[model samples]
Target: MTSLKLIFSLFIISFYSCSYVYAADLKKLAIEEFKKANYPKAIEILEHALIENNDDLELYYCLGYFTHYLCYDSVPLTGFDIRKSDEVLAYLGKAVELKPSYGDAYYFIGAEYGVRARRHLGKGEVDRAVFEFRLAREKGGLPDWLIEYGRNNLKTCDRDAILFTGGDADTNPIEYLQLVENYRRDVTVIPIALLNRPWFVQMIKYGIENAINAAPISWSREQIHDMHPYKWKTNLILIAVPETIKAELQIDKDFEWELEPDFEGRLSAGAAVLADIVKTNQWARSIYFSVACHPGMYHGLGDFFQSCGTTYRLIPTQTKDTELELDIKCIEDVFMDGDNYKSIASVADNNMPRASHMLNNYRAALFRLLIHYYKDKNKRRAKEVLDFMESTIREEYVASGALGEHLASYRKLLE
Candidate 1:
């Protein structure tokens, strides 16, 4: 018994020592990410740090601050995302509770309320906003950046249960739709590459099926392989993981699931299972891949998706041709274009990648419409599509060489 006690004590000491050693490094990494305008990544790092040592007040405060930047301060506020808003409060409140004298925490609380006020005032709902601003001023005057955030933010867009499998770039549109417009709430998001782990798959399986707090799955790797999504009958396949994990998997030919010859690059065990989930579930739900999704997924899915805006939505009957009318409308109005896009996309240097990516996808969709009409021998509609595509591409992505080539080539083909 004495020996057992000694071993347990040594284990505890080792754990604490390791956490203490890594805590400072974690904090430093999060700060660097913050400087790079990678708010989500920064928060993710600190969240792990808190797990290492939950008692770290500064970590809590930093977590709260970066989360605010992610949701409100960094971009032009578009929606009242309760999930994020409540999350901000939970972290900030924990910080405040941990250290009542943490004036910055108080300031953040107030600024968040001020953002709420700004949203309210936009709709001519003045009283609540005033109260929130007053609360903010009581803690600290609104920082210049926070003031700018609320000033530029306004409500926009609409959608129904649109879920994203990738990063902020892919998710922001639906976030605005659901939060600002209070549109749809049934969206389910599974973070990138989470499907790569056997444990994560089991978590997804049980967590989703049970609708409860998911404990880490203890299944062996073989167990994970056998637990295909086809068995689950889930709706939709969202391929968001990059190619890194894809190199590790093999498609089971005996399984009757065929990824395209040249296009099916590779799939991790978890990703292959996820694809099967969409396939075995009767192909009823839409499978959308973000621009970041491996090309293998895009091509291997083999004409299953109708490229719509930034996402390639799984369509049963055809490709982009059928969705041209509705999707073109979505592109023009909704696919992050025009002055609003320019302003929001300009705020952070890092944001440009996703913005350009989204614009590129929309451009490709438009070009597809042109080709669809041209092939149909519908000269009038074809010409109309060509005109719209040319003008919009030039307006949004003036510097895209590929887009320029597409315009020149497609124009020749149309004629």
Candidate 2:
């Protein structure tokens, strides 16, 4: 009898483990419902799944996404109800509490808040919108597109050329045009600063040298024997790429290299250089570059920017693709006018003191460029963008922090 009881207990434990293992799959089913535009079905399944596994962290995360996506679908025109948004935000908040590491949870919470803040615009809620957008960038993993959108909107808000101020003396056409040109110019040249970055260059050289020496190359016996010559020659060539690229591009690498040591370094140097140009002319300013982080650079791209004291762009570079763009555009159009993405137009109109937000938008715009290019190619960059969804009491989605931490890891799995 005791042996039979023990066997029964073992069977029960196995069943429990199996269920948990399959939970993500079940949750995905609900996500499919979402994909098919069956929000009600998705919500229903998610609710049921959540009920069954109340402690499932991912379930909560998915529930948050379902609500967040719905919110995303509502914007300036179609519009989202603040009351409905509150419910979704509550779920997202719960998801974060259950799984603090769940980056998506944090992101959705911020996004929901951003919409609310925007909705409250002109009603003493501009500050609230800024707060929500900041949070969304922090947690949802700001991709370059989002940052650019936000940044442009911010510029619009600050410059006030298009609306509100009605093109006053401060919003002189030539002056505002110059501002746009200057900001765009800064973005086009961002890669120059990034590639010829001293620390980044130095680190890449080191890695390449090491990789070359260790790389299985077909070396002649004499060449192999002379390790000293090989090492010296390899190091020289490795260090030369930055200079070579700069020369070919006709860019001033030396000047960009000098703008390093921290984000402040970049911001201060840029501001200092442009001080006489912009009327305000602040001595030291913080410029936020909304960069999609990539691992190809020695320091994750974000850190490289931060190293110069520039605020890091709050987006992930890897996820940029045609589908994602469509997802955003579709969502954007669902809520706002198809062409009007000037959510931050208010900030620019106000002549906001800081230009950090403008910088972030530049980064995001660049990301859109990359995404546009990626869409033109026939290559399959991301290997594991699964079509599967999970089952839950509410809309549940599963995201792995470990998986999204670095580019190499993502390439390995995604490719």
Highest TM-score scorer: 1
Q: All candidates' lDDT scores?
A: 0.52, 0.37
Q: Once model 2 is optimally superposed onto the true structure by TM-score, how far is the C-alpha of residue 169 displaced, in angstroms?
A: 31
* Residue lDDT tens for model 2, 1-415: 9999999999999987777766766798998988886666787788887766778887877877776665544222234677777788778777867865565465455456545543443243434544544554455434333343433432322121111111111111111222222332122112222122233222222222111111112323443233221111111101122454346435443221111222422332222222111112121222223222223222222321221111232111122232322223322222123233333333232222212233332323323332333445522422211111011100111122332233234335434
Estimate, for each residue in 309-376, the C-alpha lDDT of model 1 and write its tens digit: 55555444333334422345544455334443333333222223222344454456566666666777
CA lDDT of 85 in candidate 1?
A: 72
Report clashes for each candidate as comma-separated counts. Answer: 4, 54
Q: Which stretches of candidate 2 lie above 4 Å from their native place?
A: 1-5, 71-79, 122-415
Superposed on all Cα atoms, the candidates' RMSDs to the truth, in angstroms, are 16.8, 24.8
For residue 14, what is the lDDT in candidate 2? 92
Positional deviation of residue 107's Cα in model 1 after best superposition, in angstroms: 25
